[model samples]
Structure formats: structure tokens, C-alpha cells
Target: MLSVESLSKSYGKKEIFKDISFSVQPGNIIGLVGENGAGKSTLLSILATLQSPEKGSIALFELDYKSKKREVRKHIAFVPQDIALWEDLTVEENMMFFEKLSWKKKGKEELKQLCSNVKLDRWNERVKTLSGGMKRKLNLAVSLIHDPELLLLDEPTAGIDLKSRKEIGNYLKKLALENGKMIIYTSHDMDEITNLCDQIICIGEDPFYQEILTETGKNILSF
Candidate 1:
């Protein structure tokens, strides 16, 4: 399980998060939702270990992110808000580079299988030549190549076509259901949150809310 306790951050005098707490179990999909500048990205960054919070801590399973940064990172994969890939590199080359950096070697068949699973089979094209949706797909493929236990996505479906959104959503759902990987995604799209997440954590300053939604109904709270 992933646990966040009283996570707080500040930029000079401006406070981003005051005291946030949440937990995500295996096979759970959590949505981080808020308006712009509501600290959604900051919170995700803290959870991803890209940055540290001024107060509080995060734990994946039994590993503490603060003390076991490297170990924690190995179990988590973060897809940033922007597409961070080498535009000059071919799609397959990008994936291969990331796979190698992950220090995990797979047979040729497994590598091909990973590409097919992410629907990047025809990825010989350069990343710069691919469409926005295709680039996002490749980004997700690279993040999952190491098979991290937790996947953190920051507005991954933003600015993509509807078809791509659905495809990515389905793939993430499959990973959680079939592979038992935990997923935490952040987005401002209410429909995406409603459809893809089992629980929603709403963050803001004046008013904050957190809700857990199931097929039947929702449990809501205000903070």
C-alpha cells in the first residue's frame, strides 16, 4: 500500500498543501483533482519523489520515500505533466533507452511484447514525427517497461484526442485489474475522474474535499 501522511509544502510564503493524507492499496485507482494552481502537481511531485515536501512523508509498502529514495523510486514510475522524451529518438529507441536505464534486461520477445501491449508496435517512427497522442502512448509505455508497482500520471490524457484518452484509460484499468498495479492519476477532467478512478482526492485552499466512489454510491467529506 502507498500511504501519505500530513503532506505539506510551501513556495516561500505561499502554502501549497496544508495537511494532506491519503492511502492507496494495490489494484486501487486514485484521482487527484483540483483547479489550476491548486497544488495538484505539487502533491503528485511529492509522491513521485521528484521533490520533497516541507512537512510530512510518503511510504510505498514499507519503504519510506525520504530515507529510501532510490528504493522507493524503483517501485514507482512517474509520468510527468509534460511529454519528456528525446524528440530525435525513434519510438523504439526511446523505449529501449529507458528500459536499459532501468537496469532490467528482457529478451527480444519480451521487448516486442511490451511494445505490442502499449500499442506501439509501429513505433519505428521518430518521436518528433508522431502525433501528440502517439507520443503520450510512448511515454506511458516507457514508464511501464520496468513494471513498477505504482504508476503516477500527471494529467496524462490532457490535450489528447478522445480515442487516445479512452485507449489510455483502458490500458491503465487493465494494468490495475489484471496486473494488480496501483495507479494514481491527476486531472481536472471530471468525466475522466468519474470514469477512471475508484477514489477521488479534491484539493483546494478555501474548500477541500475527498471522496471514495464505488459502483453503488460515493462517500464524500469536506475539509
Candidate 2:
């Protein structure tokens, strides 16, 4: 559903990555791996259309991102590394806010169902009162509120308990396998990559250091 070709990005004097190319299809769970400062999030930011690449093209559903910004955005949802909910808002309030922002206001029942799928059970609890894991799920729930076809997650599982991690992982897998959502996510933990992704892309200091994980996610080798 997404295609990127010859993508290049750099800072003033330092090059992050260049000549990068990849495509993601519906029902594909792509894991992005890289060392800190290796530009994983930067790459994701470009894919989310929050930033522009110096060179190359990004297309979503055959629509050129450069020219069809609004069309592509309608199909993409990005969950950043930081929590994006008001700490004082109750669960219902938080979902409602995002739903309205999506320009598609779903009913409370629909919103509650989204929270339930993310394993967030407290509808009346304030955001600050929820556990770290619940917060993560709530973040995800907010992203799904729009029902976008492409989901980009940066450290979605970070700082959550193990159970929550696995739960979130399984739900993501379900999104790909059953809901036919295309997912691109990043994590420091290799195991999360192994457990959730159908393919893995690794970035490193060497510009040529690109590898795709096996379908089982058991191994990574050059394409």
C-alpha cells in the first residue's frame, strides 16, 4: 500500500541515509530496526509526511505523496514515541477528542470497542490514573480511531510491562493478519521484531546495511 524509492535525507553536514527504497503491502507488518540516531524515526517521519526527503518519492495506494498529501494522509496514522493524550482527560474524553479530530466522530460505543480491542478497560479512569501499559494501548486506540489503513508506530511497546508488550504485539499481528492493515514499527528489542513482524528492515552506520528479516522473523539477510 506504500512505496518509497531512492529516498535520501541528511542534516547540515551529516548524511542519515540515501538511496533507500522499500515498499509495504497490505497485511504486511514491517519492523524497522536501527541504533540510536540511525534515523529510524526520521524515516518514519518522512513516511508520515511530517517531513520531506531531500530526494526520492513516496507513494501511498499509487498516489504520489508529493502531490497528493491530503489523500495519502487520509490513509495514514502515526503514533509517535511520546504519549499523546491529555493527562487529565478520562478515557472516554480522550478517545472522543481524537475521534472528532479525525473528522469522523464515532459513537462512544465504537470508541469503547476500540479501547477494548487495545485491552484498555477503564472508560471512566483519568489518563493519569491508568498504568503505563494502558497508556500505550490508549495511544494505539486513539490512532485506530480514524481506522486508517497504514499505521506507523515509533516505540509503541516501550516502557510497558511484559504482559502488555505481548498483548500489544499480538494485537498488532492481528491487525495485519486479520484486518489487513499495513504496519511499520520500530523497537530496540529484537524479540518484539521477531514476534510481530512479517519482515524486518535494519539500518545502521553503513548506508548499505539493509537487511530483511525472514518471514518467520528468525533471520535477516540482504535482499
Candidate 3:
């Protein structure tokens, strides 16, 4: 559902990626694994259309990101490593606001259901009062408000407890299995990738280090 071809990016004098290319099929969960400076996040950002690559192109569901940005964006959702939420708004209100922005309008019940789906139903309190995990759940819920076809999640389970991490992973797996949504996620946790991804992509300083699989099987990497 997503294709990235000849993707390369650099920050001033520092080069992160060169000719990085990959494709994600429908109903597949792709795990992006790499070291700290391996360009995982940069590649994701390019796919998310948040940052333009210095070279190469991205296409989502056949729509070229550079030429059909609006249409591509409608089918893509991005969940960043950091939680993005309105701290002062009540949990329900935050969900409602984003739902309206993304989906025109969503009933209270529907919003509540989404919250529940992400295990945030009990967090009806104001966002400022919720714990970090609660806020992360809120972030996940917001990303799904539009029912995007391609979901890009970056370090989504970072800093959360084991229980919440599992919940998030299970939720993502359900989305791919039940809804056939294409998922591309970046993570440092080997266990999460082992459990949730149908295929894994290991990126490093050299593009040769990257590998894609077709099953949830582990492959050891040699430096």
C-alpha cells in the first residue's frame, strides 16, 4: 500500500539515508528496526510527508506524495514518538476535537469507543491530569480518528509500562488483521517487533544492513 523509492535524506553536512527503498503491502505490519542514528525516524518522517527527502520519492496507495499530497494524507496517519495532545482539554473533548477535524463529526459514543479500543476509556479526566501512559493512549486514539488506510507509528510504545505496551501492540495487530490496514512502525524493542510485525526491516549505516521479511520470524543481524 506504500512504496518508497530511492529515498535519501541529509541534515546539512550529515547524511542519514541514501537510496533507501521499501514497500508495505496491505494487511501487513512492517517493523523498522535500527540503531539510534540509523535514519529510522527520518525515513518515517519522509513517508509521513512531514519532511521532504533530499532525494527520491514516496507513494502511498498509488498516490505520489509530492504530486498528490492531499489525497495521500487523507489515507495516512502518523503517530509520533512524542505525545501530541491538548493538555487543558478533557480527554473526551480532545478526542472529539480531533475527530471533528479528521472525520467531520463523530458521536460521543464513537469517540468513547475509540478511547476504549485504545484502553483509554477510563481517562475521561482532563488530559493534564492523566499519566504518561494515558496520554500515549490518547495519542494513539487520535491517530485512528480518521480510520486511515496506512498508519505510521514512530516509537509508539516508548516509555510506557509493559501492560500498556502490550495493549498498544495488540491494538495495532488487530487493526492490521481485522481491518487490513497497512502499518509501518519504528521501534527499538525487539520483543514488540517479534510479536506484532509480519515483516521486519533492519536499517543501519549501510543500506545493505536492511532486510525485509514476509513472516513474524526473527533474523539476527551481524555488523
For all candidates in order, the CA lDDT equals 0.82, 0.87, 0.83
TM-score result, candidate 2? 0.93
| lDDT: worst 10-residue window of model 1 | 214-223
Better of 2 and 3 by lDDT: 2
Give the winner by lDDT: 2
Error of 2 at 63 (Å): 1.3
lDDT of 2 by residue, 1-223 (tens): 8998989899988898888888899999988887789889999999999999999999999999999999899899999899999999999999988888885679989999988998889999999999999999999999888789999999999999999999899899999999999999999887788877777777765434343343343534222
Clashes of each: 0, 0, 0
**Stretches of candidate 2 exceeding 4 Å from the true structure:** 206-223
lDDT of 3 by residue, 60-135 (tens): 8789999999888898889999989899999988988888788546788988998999888765699989878888
- Candidate number achieving the greatest TM-score relative to the actual structure: 2
Q: Clashing residue pairs, candidate 1? A: none
Provide the lowest-lDDT 10-residue window in model 2.
214-223
